[model samples]
Target: MRNFLYGAITSAAIATLTVSTLTVAPALSAERLSLSTWGSPAHYQVAEFVPMFKQLLEEKSDGDIRLKTFEGGEMVKQQFVATAVPQGTIDISLTTLDNWSGRVADVGILTTPLWDKSMEWTRDNLKPGNPVFDYFDAKLRDEGAIIIAMFDIGAPVVSTSFEITGPEAFANMPIRAYSKGSAQVLQTLGAAPTIMGVGDVYSGLQRGTVKGAMGGLGGAVGLKHYEVTSNMFVPNGVMGTLIHAYVMNKAKFEGMSPENQKILMEAAAEARDHMQQVAIDQLASLLDTVRENGNTVTIVEPGSPTWEAFAKQLEPLAREATQSYPQEVQDLIAAD
Candidate 1:
């Protein structure tokens, strides 16, 4: 009886070890893909996104493909990720489209009020099919990049050294804005809008070149701008914008085995969902951090007379900026 028990124990141990080895094993063919993005290591997207992708990709590829990441300036300047990916200098880049607006005009459609509520709208309309992805997939494919997964960075809010309590306040300040919405939103408030790079915003604020800016919470913290200019004006008309992308070089993506490609896509789609949840959670934390640092937070009420008045004033620019997309896309979102 004792001998029988010993034999059973030995068998169970071997089975457990076999399973462990299989679970942790790497693929026979190992390939490392390098990814780059314009975010500093401290950037929320990078901190939350990079490791999640690496782990998911590794598990999906069953260890066959490993992602190597180069962040901050080493991979090329942060804003250059989209530009570099086309050249194949970097296999993939996590990017913000606002920076690439010059190259792809419709890309900014989401950045403006046209798609302000698009997070819910797009998911409601196009998740299973992802037509926007289809549209952009083709657009990006032509540039030698493929969009596999994406998420919103959270709505961008305008933070400033100056307070913009009313239209006049908004106007007198030649606001440094991010994408087309920034231009439209600030312009409606009666301010001159200048498209400014993320890196340039700090200097612009400090030197009084820009009295204020429209940006997100993470951006203000990451750039250390709160240290200089400390008021946050949160507007209801799309204070946030979506961000995050996991893309691959066209040639590299196509080179993957069909089975591996499917595996990668599945993982990426799941990651996209994870990213969206993270953004929503982080937004509150980011706001708390701003206040803890001694900055004032002003909530811009949605659909108030002030908001509607601003929108009415800037409707023309909004319409022109949103022309490339279906008018309904903007109207449904703008309607509220």
Candidate 2:
């Protein structure tokens, strides 16, 4: 009986050792992820957040997961992220919802000039438990992708060769439009809107093909749009925020262990907060960069005669574009 008890204990110890070996063997080999972004290396999306997220993920996972980054369309074009990520051409991609707006109508709402809330308001309202965010998650999941985080790209301004002091000043000027909603807004203000990518705006403005371009403060400075434009018209609260989302392939995300999944998500939230705060903190400096580059900055006061006229025309145009959303979604978005 003593020998039999000793034999049983030995077998139990061997079984436990084997189970431990099986559980830890996979972790010894790192899982390599191909992470891509459309932004240039210096852009905050790539510069500030991507590295931080990668580091956090790898460290927390003890090098079990590794992120290999592709910056500035290295893996694919900016607009192809949605398809690429799901097809496994890339594991993750950072881009704005506007890139896939053609596939998801609600995605375009992020780019529409209808956002009147502050960044803090937007952050709070779109948190995990919020219906607004839940709606977005459902919409994205249908596309075989998941949004890890969303960020504000700051408000865009009209940088024009001529001054836009009032609605009348917009007459007949050819402005570069970044989105269809923006095009309608410009048209309502009597400006001829030409559609083009932000990257093309510098050359378009420089070559006199377009008199002005709608762009974010950071983009104008980063892309050097100030070199060609003479004026920056910050049209009060009417100027909408350019929000960006960090998206990952849903299947890939689901394939990870719950701990790694949580690690990735937590890192994303931190990166989102860090990026937005950095952008907000750098707004003054970005505007100063514009001025130093020889562009005059004009802030149109809210509710002023000029502001009222622009808002009156723009609000209806924006609403019409986003009318497809349920009333609740619209109300939630438009609400304070």
Q: What is the TM-score of each candidate against the true structure?
A: 0.80, 0.85
lDDT (Cα) of model 2: 0.76
lDDT of 1: 0.69
Count backbone overlaps in model 2: 0
Give Cα-based local distance difference scores for all models. Answer: 0.69, 0.76
Per-residue lDDT over 1-336 for candidate 2, one digit per residue giving the tens place of the 0 to 100 score: 999999999999999999999998877666777888763467776778888888888888888888888876778665577678667788888766666666677766665565666766655555566666677777888888888887776667888899887888889989988766567667888899987765578889999999989866666777777878898988745756677778888999998889888888888888777877787788788788888888898987777888887777677667675676567667767664
Q: Which ranges in model 2 have alpha carbons more than 4 Å from their true place?
A: 1-28, 318-322, 334-336
Residue 146 C-alpha lDDT in model 1? 83
Worst 10 residues of 1 by lDDT: 119-128
lDDT of 1 at 202: 84
Candidate 1 segments exceeding 4 Å error: 1-28, 118-128, 184-188, 238-240, 322-336
